[model samples]
Target: MLNYRLFGDLSSSAAPLVVLHGLLGSLDNWHTFARGQAGKRTVLAIDLRNHGDSPHVAGMSYRQMVDDVVAVLDTLAIPECYLMGHSMGGKVAMMLALQHPSRVRRLLVVDIAPKAYPPRHQALLHAMVGMPLGELSSRKQADEWLSATVKHPFERGFLLKNLGRKTEGQFYWQCNLPEIARHYLKISGFPTTDAVYPAPTLFIRGGQSDYVADTDLPMIRQAFPAAELVTVAAAGHLPHVQTPAEFTVLVEAFLG
Candidate 1:
């Protein structure tokens, strides 16, 4: 099972919202947004397997990931809940809704489509896997090293969130880098499924991102007949992070 943090009143009449983060991301990425919605609805932010405080395992398939989510929900005694996920996590949410439709009330998939994606994160993965944690004296040095492959400072900072200090000066990655790198292909590709989840679904895309293309709508509609697509203006892949206020409004309205 994955480690999760709960916000708001779980006993409230409002249906609980479960959030799953993207690849190389943890529950912490959604902390602020979850906290913002805590007053109105119960929110559960989870660290998927191999990320953040969750148990590190070998297999990184969508099936295994969905099982981990189910385990968390089962332990919480939550029969069903609203699910929101980003990037790779969005794919997980889609799979879960298909495999166990009864467990999902509403679905929100952010900046991803239910189709196979070409290998795009290999360079980033190589940089992350090749980071010399033992040689790094400070997070700044680690950032400098990553900057060789990761050009964007913001992205480097985001990836640096996985850096954890074991001792006073030594830093190591909290994520299971080796396993993720090995299963990169699986992570990039969506698992084959003929199953359809006949529930209300929302696909939120970033206007600046190519992750969700016009070609994906037909597939999305075929799987989720009631699914609707919305785009966040001036936002990229991480729309929730870039345009949080707008994102929150969209979510609250849809979930309501």
Candidate 2:
């Protein structure tokens, strides 16, 4: 089962809010958002397969990831919940809602359209997978080396979250980097399903992010006809992280 963190009461009268992180992200990345929502309802932050503390499996298919989450929900006895996700996780949420509409009472997708994206992270994946973990003695060294390919401080730090220490004290990547690289195209592509999720849904995008283009709206509307779109002007790619207060407000308003 996928590793997950649950907050709020198990018997909370409200359906839980299940949050899924983006590519190269773990449950820890959504701590702020989950905590903010947990105050009013149960919140489940899950580490998708091959990321974070979850098992490092070979495939990264949205179907597989969706099932992984379903397995966790089944284990926890959560019949349905307010589901949300960011980027790649957004795709998973979209798939889950479409594949299992009864399990999602409401849906919130962040910064991703229900269409395929080109393979943009291959170079970065290769860089991370090809890192000399055996020679790196410190996280600082890893950061310095990664800086060669990943220049932005924030993104570099975010990617470094995958670094884990072996029992012998050597640094290793906890995320299944090699397999992610191999299935980069699959990850970029959306799942093959003509099914649409006819539920009250909200799509939040970062004004500074190009991940969700205006051109993608028709397709998004087609798949999620009940979807409402919102943009956080001050944020880019990661509005929940960049503007937590504003994002939290939007989420709460939607849930209500």
Candidate 3:
């Protein structure tokens, strides 16, 4: 079972909002956003399988991830709620809305399309798997070592989120590196589902991100006929981080 750490007041009167983190991310990534939505709605931030405190499963397929979310929602007795996700999480949210329409009242996808991404993330995953954990001294040292293997600083930081040190001074990864490394391809690919969720869907695109290019709109529309697109200017893959105010405004309007 996937362990999910929730936030905010679950007993709030407003409709619940479940936020799923991206690849290599945990519920902590959505702390600010979840806090902003507090009182207005109950925010349930999930740490997907193999990330954060979640259990490591044998497979990393979207179907398996969706099942994890379903289990959490059912356990919470949340009848229907708003679904929001970013990058990998966006794909999961898309699948959940498609396969389990009754569970999602509103769908919000951030900076990703309904297409398969290239295996470009393989190098980063490889570097993570190859990290010299035994010799790693501190997080700064790990950062310096990872800098030699990974070029993109932001991406390196994202991967570094998994690095942790034991009380005995031995370093390890908080994430299940072997599973993520072995299933990199599956993680980048979206599942093929014939089900189309016609619920009012919102696609929040990052202006600087190529993840959701104009060319992908056709596929998005083909699957989600009622979906609408909104772009956050001067933002990249994680718009909520770059432009939280704008992202919040857009989300509030969409949820209304």
Candidate 4:
């Protein structure tokens, strides 16, 4: 089963919200957003296979990832849930709602559209895999090393979260980088399906991020016809992190 963290009251009458994070991210990434909305309803943020504290095996396909999520929901005894995901996770959420519409009460996709994207993470993943983990004594050195390819401090720090130190004084990546690298192509494309989800849906895009464009909406509406697209004008790829208050308002208004 996939690893999961819970937020808010379990006894709350509202249906639980299941959150998934982006590529190279873990459930920890959603901690701030989950905590902020904890009082309103329960939030179950999950670590997709090969991410965070979840068990890592081989497959990284969206279908396999969706199966992993379905298994988690079954294990938790949650028949239905409000679903949300960011970036790569957003694609997973879209696939889940498309495949199992009855299990999702509402869907929220952050900063991504339900379509195939060109492979853009090749350099980043290569830099990470080629990093000298053994020679790195501190995160500072690792950051400096990665700075050759990853210039932005925000992205550098985010990816570095998967780096961990063992009790024996050895550092290792917490995520399955090799597996992710191996299936990067599969992760970039979405599954072709004629399925459509008719439930309430929200698609929030970071205005500064070109991940989702106005041109993608007609195609997005084709899959999630009920989807309402909104732009977080001041934010980039991570709207929730860049502008928490505004993000919260949008989430609350949509879920309510």
Q: Write the per-residue lDDT of candidate 1 for residues 1-256, one digit (tens) a residue.
A: 7899999756766569999999999999998899898568899999999999999998999999999999998998888999999999999999999999999999999999988899999999998888888898888999999988899898888899999998677899899989999999999999888999999999999999999988889989988999999999788999999899999999999998
Tell me model 4's lDDT, rounded to 2 decimals. Answer: 0.93
Cα lDDT of model 3 by residue, 129-154, tens digit: 88789988788888888787787788
What is the C-alpha local distance difference test score of each model?
0.92, 0.91, 0.87, 0.93
lDDT of 2 by residue, 146-194 (tens): 8889989999999999999987989988888888888889999997778
TM-score, each model?
Answer: 0.98, 0.97, 0.96, 0.98
Give Cα distance to truth, residue 51, candidate 1, Å.
0.3
Instruction: Output the TM-score of candidate 4.
Output: 0.98
lDDT of 3: 0.87
Which parts of model 2 are misplaced by more than 4 Å? none
Model 3 ranges with Cα > 4 A deviation = none
TM-score of candidate 1 relative to the true fold: 0.98
RMSD of each: 0.9, 1.1, 1.3, 0.9
Report the poorest 10 consecutive residues by lDDT, candidate 2. 32-41
Q: How far does residue 75 in candidate 2 sit from its true spot (Å)?
A: 1.1
Candidate 3 lDDT at 74 equals 88
lDDT of 4 by residue, 110-174 (tens): 99998889999899999999999989888899999899999999989999999999998888999
Model 3 TM-score is 0.96
Task: List pairs with backbone clashes in candidate 4.
Answer: none
